[model samples]
Target: MTAITKGAPRAFVLLRSRRRLDLLDPDPEAWTDEDLAGGLSRTMRWGGASQWEHPLSVAQHSLTVLAIREADGALTAGEGLRELLHDATEFMLGWDCITPLKAQLGEPFRALEARLQTAIDARYRLPRWTPEDYALHKRADRLAAASEAMHVVGWSRVEMRKTLGIAETPLVHDPLSPCAFAPWEPWPPRVAERLFLERFHALDHAHRSELRKLEPELRSSLVLTGAEHAAS
Candidate 1:
């Protein structure tokens, strides 16, 4: 590990991969993909509340969002990767605070999360979200939250709208049901970790393939720009 500058703030956590992450100043390469998958699988959503055998995990929630987006239409590899990692920072922080709670945590907490998210984005080379894309992502995220609240967290439709402040109707059919797990059932940590890693690797492969396909065009564009510069 690189030496921390004297007097600089540091909060370190040992990862499952036997790597240390400095939470105050995170190094994107310090944690492996497996570390992220394991952390996410253990990070509970809905403040760890559950109506079933286990609390819903951020890993499962991420897959749910990706599935929802896939159900909408075919997605580019980048889009799929974005959906899969939208909340990845929560895994590193070891907390998935509810929206209302996040507000209460104030700007300092938000800044910390933002720093961590920046690191995650760098690590994954995630695409930036356009306004329309961000709106779509939020819609899917809310839909997943609504469905999980109703089926997994035991919130009624009325309560979802009133108490949870979710206006979207919960999805009747779980998007991930096709995976052979019970509908809306939260998988155990080990199962969630395995599934999350599988999806991540698949998406990563496709994303890299797409990037490779674009490389020749990118080189041509760069060469054209250089010629134009010389002619000017």
Candidate 2:
């Protein structure tokens, strides 16, 4: 990675929409699903330090988080969309900091992340996170973290709970079923990107209509299935 000179003109990333986006001062209008999917597919969680052969990408992690949220309870389309893109701005920023590290980075980092997140929220038409929303999101996130640490990074459950501050052990795995919190496996980046976009449209009001309008094949992919359909 080439270091940006301190006094130099800032660099811009050209999105698939042919929009030039300033990362330091991003415009919500400059990003799209294609940009998010593509960027996030390539950004790995834990900075690609997992014990697995392939590192878990943030795109796959986002999908997992959304799945956990959906499994939790009945959610409105907007709520589900919020869970899906909770870390959406990280895709554009190209890195995810751990909670401790983020605090250490101080106010400047927080400000930048806040601005980026606000822009991302605007782009997706997601409402601001309510206190209830934060509590819900945090629970699901910690559960996912515990599962990921245990499965992908080979951390012991006790270690995860005590060392990583993950208190949710019940979600570590389901002894009764193979579906829930089974294990973390890295999805192929291309597959992750496509599925992330599919999930986004399935939850996004405008995009859901657009998918039905523009592509029938996409409609099949977007429709709620099995338990989800029943639950909905």
lDDT score at residue 163, model 2, on the 0-100 scale: 83
lDDT of 1 by residue, 1-232 (tens): 8887998889988999999999889898999999999999999998899988889999999999999989888999889999999999988889898888889989999999989989988888788999999999999999999999999989898988888789998999877863657899999999999999999999999998998899999999999999999999
Candidate 2: where is the Cα deviation over 4 Å? Answer: 1-11, 16-18, 170-182, 206-232
lDDT of 2 by residue, 1-232 (tens): 3455788766477766776777777778877778888888888887687776677778777777777777878877777888888888787778878889998999989988888888887777675688987898888777777777777777787887788777777455521121322356666677678878887877897544543575766555567455577797
Cand. 2 Cα-lDDT: 0.75
Off by over 4 Å in 1: 178-180, 227-232
Clashes of each: 0, 0
- The candidate scoring highest on lDDT is 1
Cα lDDT of model 1 overall? 0.92
